[model samples]
Target: MSGLFVPMTKANGLGNMPDLLEQWAGSRSVARAYGRAGLPMEVIQFPETWIPVDAIRSLFEISARAAGDRCFGLHVGKDMTHKTFGLWMKYSVQAATLRDGLIRANQSSRFQQTGGKVVFVPGAQVSFWRYVAPPMQTSSQVQHCDHLIWPTIRFIQSYLGPLWLPEWVDVSYPRDADARLLEAQVPFPVRFGTPYLSMAIRNRDLSPRTPRPFGDGQRITFDAVRASEAAGPSNETLGTVFNTITLRLLEGQTDIDGAACQLGIGVQKLQRDLRREGVDYRDLLNRAKRVRAQELLSDTDMTVIDIALSLGYSDHGNFSRAFRKMTGVAPSGFRARKDQMQ
Candidate 1:
């Protein structure tokens, strides 16, 4: 309603203590780094509070201008989104395709913490509802929806001017915005006594036209993003080549030179760039292999040998040994530990 409300479900962390600790520590630490570096982490995290950490990581990779270890928040804060959204306010102003945007946001619940829910209330009008998972230490959901509420409204207004309007809206939870003037931004009729966070909209406008051109302008590859996010440009063409090769290797192919040529760079240049990144092409390939191998083992039911070939490993023994070298355990043991964490 008035305050943030993070989800408390299987998708959000299943309400586990370990997961909560990981997320909470991660959020405060990353934000601390941003402030110390004179960059505004809260600017992005606060605006789209309900978004997932994966998406936020992507955003930091796009927005932050930090260097040094601070640039590493791209990796460290990869999943602190859960804690931040606990403070969102859902301010959707100037939304394009008012109803469609709202509905799509509702459908995109997969991008939020679990137990995430969006509902529509129809009582002489329309209302948008967000019911995130409740906190584990308390019987109630965090009431910071307004953190999102303002920014969301501002974003909609900027993107969808002249297409959206809200009837009086109100939520039941505590919020920082004064109750008497809640409509200054929302400017809708408000019945504060209501039981849910809801928007009042015209019933006839439930289905507005979709926004044109689904894609945004800039298009950067994951490798480019990863490199740029580290506060540097493409100093690691081999990392780029390694990424390409890993994709092919995952598909059970082995054309190392093919990947090098695909990037339109010479073999020597690729090798030199990766070496500058403190790794050789083979080391990167092995790292990718180990990373993917660990992930598949931990997240899926794929067998060891299938993963070995998928990573271009000559044999399962070699794969197992490499995995053990990096992770200090066999693939099966790693998977079991991952499973136990769940």
Candidate 2:
């Protein structure tokens, strides 16, 4: 929960970077860089997959050595789009405002990443976003830090239109380790050795914008929900177990008894353990359903009935009551507002 957890798709920039390096540096250099980083030549070959955060950081290191003092991360982060995070990215960008978009991204982030979560703090004139992570123990973490901050800026840029820029960028690392190339790309000041790695933007920039109208891509993004299953906490903590059950529910498996059996425990024992952990099984289930329902209402054209069925509800009436109890809005009403705002 304190350290970074990244999605496999985060390394996808490496696939595109080799070609970019071949263009900016040379094909020979790309091979040599990968080799120096002790990676396979096929490291340049990109696939649509999700991997652990540490692994992606390793790939970023290889790309960095290959690029050699060039602004590697800045370029890679700049080219990022919704496709980078698949469905989660798609749903986030379609939010009503930059703030709302970021919150949506944070909610759906576990669908793409589970090691850390986005923390947003609002102020009277400015707002800050921190990709909170645990203490670093690996050498490759710095690379992941760079990747996290830059892509976030890029995502905000895409949401607020290209003219957007942050007030400043802050990093948890020492100032001397700063990359000059990255500094050159940032329009605002970059400060290092801060308490948290974060970005600050003016509050006005967070104003809500019009949501996008309906489109076929919405349905395609909805179908891509399965891709997010790869993201989960890599530990055995209760939160991790909660996330696992949530994923199972999303996959149309909702039986807590079966989940307990899968965990090699009886249902009653599982309940006892959850109580010891200060969580109720039903509460976890409700939270999971709430998150899933919000995503469907905001990002898909799926009707309330279809969404309820997908969440394993007996009927829309039951779904509506539960959704309202949790979110204070009916499914159809939620969808309507999302549509009108868009």
Listing every candidate in turn, what is its Cα RMSD in Å to the true structure after a full C-alpha superposition? 19.3, 12.0
Model 2 C-alpha lDDT per residue in residues 108-156, reported as the tens digit of each score: 7655554556778888898998777644444745555665666777678
lDDT of 2 at 223: 37
TM-score of model 1 (CA atoms)? 0.36
Q: Which 10-residue span in candidate 1 carries the lowest summed lDDT?
A: 8-17
Provide backbone clash counts, one per model: 33, 6
The lDDT of each candidate is: 0.45, 0.64
Candidate 1, 194-241: lDDT as tens digits: 445555556766555535532343333334423422311223343245
Candidate 1 overall lDDT versus native:
0.45
lDDT of 2 at 184: 73
Q: On a 0 to 100 scale, what is the lDDT of residue 162 in model 1? A: 44
- TM-score top scorer: 2
